[model samples]
Target: MKTCILTTDTYLNHDTGQGHPERANRVTVIIDHLKKLKSKDLIWKKPTKFDLEYLAFAHDKNYLDNVKDSFPKQGLNFLDGDTIVSPGSKEATRDAVGSILTAIDGVMKKDFNNAFCAVRPPGHHAEKQKAMGFCVYNNIAVGAYYLLEKYNLKKVAIIDFDVHHGNGTQDIFYDNEKVLYISTHQYPYYPGTGKNSEKGKYNNVLNIPLPAGTTSEEYLDAYEYVLKKLKEFKPEFILFSAGFDAHEDDPLAQLKLKSEDFYNLTKRTIRAAQLSSKGKVVSILEGGYDLNALKESAEMHVNALLEF
Candidate 1:
C-alpha cells in the first residue's frame, strides 16, 4: 500500500507574525520537496472534519470552547507567549487535528500502510487546558485517544523525537495505562518537563533525556530504550510525533542529529511496529524551524515510511 500524505492549503493562511520561526514556509518547503520525489506511491488527501467528541476525548470541553472563542477577526491573538492565532487559525488548527484523524482512519481501513500529516500550528506542547509552544491542539494525543475510543485498541504507543520534550503529551497521557508515551528530547530545555523520574501512574510513560550537543550515535543509543519498552508493551497501534528540530541545522535545540539519522530512527521504529502493531503507524508533524533542515528531515522521514 502507498503512504498517505494529509495536508491542506489552509496551513499557509495560519500566519504567525513575520520573523517568527514557525512560519508557513516550513510546510511549503516540505510539500515542495515531497512533490519532487515523483513517487507513484504517494496518496495525497485533504483532511476531513472530525466530530468534537474526538477532541474531547483528550481535551477539556471548556478548553475547546476557549480556543474557538479566542479567534480574532482582524489581528493576531496570543494563546501564550509563543502560540499565536489569527482569524484563519481556527480552521487551520482544527484541520491539524482532523488530518490525523483522517490518517488514522485510512490506516485502520487499510487504505494505506501509514500516513504523514503536514499540517501546521505544530502540536506536541498544547496541554488539555492551555496552548503553548506554537501548538494549538495536541494532534497526536487526540489521535491516540480516537484510536482507543473508536477502534477499541488496548494499547497505543506515542513516540516523540523532537529536540524539546513533549510536556503536553506527557501531561495528557501520564496516568492512562492504555497509552505508552515515550520521548527522547534535550534535557533542561524549553518547557523543561521530560525528566527520567517522571514515570506515569501506571509506569506507561518512558522518558529518555539526552544532554545538549548530543551526537547522532548517542541519540540512537538512547532510542534503544524506546524500542525496548515498545517491544515489551506490544502496542496495537503506533503513532509518531515526528519533529525534525533535532537536526544539526535547527536553531531551536542543541541535538546534532542529521537528516539521515531521522531515516534510521524511522526505519527502526517501523520495524518495531512490525512486531507489535502489524505496521499500523501514523506520523504527525510537531516541530522543525530551519527551512532546509525541516525540508530534508521531513523528506527523510516520509522516505522511510514509504520504504517500509
Candidate 2:
C-alpha cells in the first residue's frame, strides 16, 4: 500500500510573525522537498474537517473555547508566552488537527500502510488546558484518543524523538494505560518536564533524557530503550511525534544527530511497529528548525516510510 501524505494550504496562513522559529516556511519546505521526490507511491491529500468531539478527547472544553475566542480580528494574538494566533490561525490550527485525523482514518481503513502529517504549529507541548511551545492543540494526542474511542484499539504507542520533551503529550496520557508515551529528548531543556523519574501513574510514560551536546551514537543508543519499551508494550497502533530538531544544525538544542540518523530512527521505529502493530504508524510533525536540516531529515524520514 502507498503511504499517505496529509497537508493543507491553510498551514501557510498561520503566520508566526518575524524571527519566530516555527514559521510557515517549515511546512512549505517539507512539502516542496517531498514533491521533488516525485514518488509514484505517495498519495497526497488535503486534510478534511474533524469534529470538535475528537479534540475534546485530549483538550478541555473551556480551553478549546478560549482558543476559538482568542483569534484576533487582525494582526496576531498570543495564546501563551510563545504560541501566537492570527485570524487565519483558527482555520490553520483546525487544519493541523484535521491532517492528523485524516491520516489516522487513511491508515485505519487500510488506504495506506502508513501516513505522514506535515502540518505545523507542532503539537507536542500543548497540554489538557494549556497551549504552549508553539502548539495550540495536542494533535497527536487527539489522534491516539480517536483511535481508542472510535476503533476500540486496546493499546497504542506514542514515540516522540523531538529535541525537546513532549511534556504535554505525557500530561494527557499519563494515567491512561492503554496509551504508552515514550520520548527521547535533551535534558534540562525547554519546559523542563521530562525527567527519568516522571514516569506516569500507570508507568505508561517512558522518558529517555539525554544531556546537551549528545552525539548521534549516544542518541541512538538511548533510543534502544524506546524500541524495547514499545516491543514490550506491544501496541496495536503507533503514533510518532516526529521532530527533526535534534540535527546538529538546529539552533534550538545541542544534540548532534546527522540527517542520516533520522533514516535509521525511522527504519528502527518501523521495524518495531511491524513487530508490535502490523506496521500501522502515523507520524506527525513536532519541531525542527534549520530549514536545510528539516528538509533533508524529513525527506530521509519519508524515504524510510516509503521503503516499508
Candidate 3:
C-alpha cells in the first residue's frame, strides 16, 4: 500500500481577504513540494462527493443549515471574526470536508495505507455550532464520526499536534467515550482552550499545553505523553490533526519546532499505535502559517507516512 495525498483546486477559491495567514498558497506550497517528490510510493487523489448526513453527525443540523446559507454570491462572508468564506467557499468548504472522508475511505478499504489531506480553510477550530479560528467545519471531527457510524469502530484516536489547541474537536468528543482526542499546543495562546486540566467529560481528552518559545527537544519530550495516551487508548484507527504552525519559522505561533521534528512526531506516534491501528492512519491539515515552514514540515510529515 502507498501513502495517498488528497487535495482539490477548490481551495484556491477559498479567499480569506487581502492578507490572512490561512491563504490558498499554504496548500500550494505543500502540493508543489510533494509533486517534486515524484515517488511512485505516493498516490495523489481528489476528494469525492459524500453524503451530507455525515456533516450532521459532527455538527448541529441548524448550524449546517446556517453554513449552507452563509456563502455569499459575490463577496466574502464572515462566520466569525477570523473565519471567512467567499462565493467559491461553498465548494471549497465541502471539498475540505470531503477530502478527509475520501482519505478515510481509501485507508479503510486498503486502497492506501494512509493519506494526507492538503486542504483549507483549516479545521479543528470550528465547533459543533460555531465557526472560529479560520475554520468553518471540523474536518477531523467529521472523519472520526464517519469511522464510528459508518464503519462501526468503537475506539478512535485523534492526535492533534497543532501549535494551538483544538477546541472544536474537544467540544464534539468531550462526552463521547469511544473517541480519544489528544492535543499538544502553545499555552495561554490564541483560542486559549488547551489547559492540562481541561480534560473531557469522560476523561478521554488529554491536553498538553506548552508555553511559547518551547524548544524542539522540549516539544518532543512532551510528545511522549501523547504516545503514552495513544498506547493506552489502543485505537482501532488513528487520525492526525496535522498542524505545522509549531515550526520556528511560523509567524502565527511561538514554538521552536524544526521541520524535522514533524517526522519524528509522526513516526513515533504510528509506531506506538501500529499494533492496534494496523497502520490505518489519516491526516488532515489544520494550521501552519509560514509558507516555507509549512512546505518543509509537511514534507517531513509525509516522508514518515511514506516510509511507514
Candidate 4:
C-alpha cells in the first residue's frame, strides 16, 4: 500500500506577515522536497472539506465561533501575541484541520497504508478554548476525537515529538480515557506545561521532558518510555504530532537529535504500533524552524513510513 501525503494550497495564503518563524515556507519546503522524490509508492492528495460539527468535538463551540469571527478582512489579527491570522487564514485554518481528517479517512478506508499531513498554523499548541504557540486548532486533538466518535475506536494514541510540549493536546485529552497522549519535548521551555508529574487523569498522558542539551542518544533512550506506554495501552489507532525542531540542526529549541534519528524513531514507533494499530498511522507537521533540518528530517520520517 502507498503512503498518502495530505496537503492543500491555502497554507500559502496564511500570511503570518513578514519574517515570522512559523511562516508559510515551513510546509512549502517539506512539500517541495517530498515532491522531488521519484517514488511511485507515494500518493499525494488534497484535503477535502469536512463538517464544522466535528470541530466542536475537540473545541468549545463558542471558541470555534469566535475563531470564525476573528479572521480579518485584510491585514493580520492576533489570537494571542504569537498566533496570527490574515484574510486567507480562515480557509487555511480549516484546511489544516481538514488535512488530518482526510488523511485519517484514507488510512481507515485502506486507500493508503498510512499518511502524513503537511500543513501549517501548526496545531498541538492550541487548547480547547484558546490558541497559542502559533497553533490555532489542535489538529491532532480533532483527529483523536474523530477516531473515538466517528470510527467508534476505543483506544487512540497520539505521540508528539515536537521540541516544545504539546500543552493544548494534553489539555484536550487529559480527562478522556479513550485517548492516550504522549510527548517528548524540551522541558522548562515555551508554554511550560509538560512535566513528569503532569500525567493525565486516567494516567493516559506520558511526558518525557528532556533538558536543553539533550543528545540524540539521550533522546532515543527516553523514547523507550513512550514505546513502553504504547505497548501497554495497545491503542487501536495512532496519530503523530511530527515536529522536527528537535533536530540538532534546528533553531527553535536546544535538543540535539539528527535528521536520521527521525527515521529511526519513526521506524521504531511503527514497529511498536504494529500489533495495536495494524500499521494505521497519520502524522501532521508541527514545528521545525531551520528549513534545511525541517526538509531533511521530514523526508527521513517519510522514508520510515514508506518502509512500512
TM-score of each: 0.99, 0.99, 0.99, 0.99
lDDT of 3 by residue, 5-36 (tens): 99999999999998888999999999999999
lDDT comparison, 1 vs 3, better candidate: 3
* Model 1, span 1-308: residue lDDT tens: 59999999999889889888999999999999999999999989999988977888778999999988999998899989989999999899999999999999999999999999999988889999889999988999999999998999999999999888999999999999999999999998898899999999999999999989999999998898898898889999999999999999999889999999999999898897687699999999999989999999999999999986
Q: How many residue pairs collide in each prediction?
A: 0, 0, 0, 0
> Which 10-residue window of candidate 4 scores lowest in summed lDDT?
52-61
Worst 10 residues of 1 by lDDT: 267-276
lDDT per residue, candidate 2, 1-308, as tens digits? Answer: 58889998898889878989999999999999999989999989989987888899999999999988999999999888789988889998898899988998998889998999999889999999999999999999999999999999999999999999999999999999999999999999998999999899889999999999999999898899988888889999999999999999999999999999999999898797687699999999999999999999999888888887
User: Which tens-of-lDDT digit does each residue in 206-296 have in candidate 4?
Assistant: 9999999999999999999998999999999889999999999887799999999999999999899899899999999999999999999
After superposition of all CA atoms, the RMSD between model 2 and the true structure is 0.8
Candidate achieving the largest lDDT? 3
lDDT of model 1 at residue 36?
A: 94
Off by over 4 Å in 2: none
* Candidate lDDT values, in order: 0.92, 0.92, 0.95, 0.94
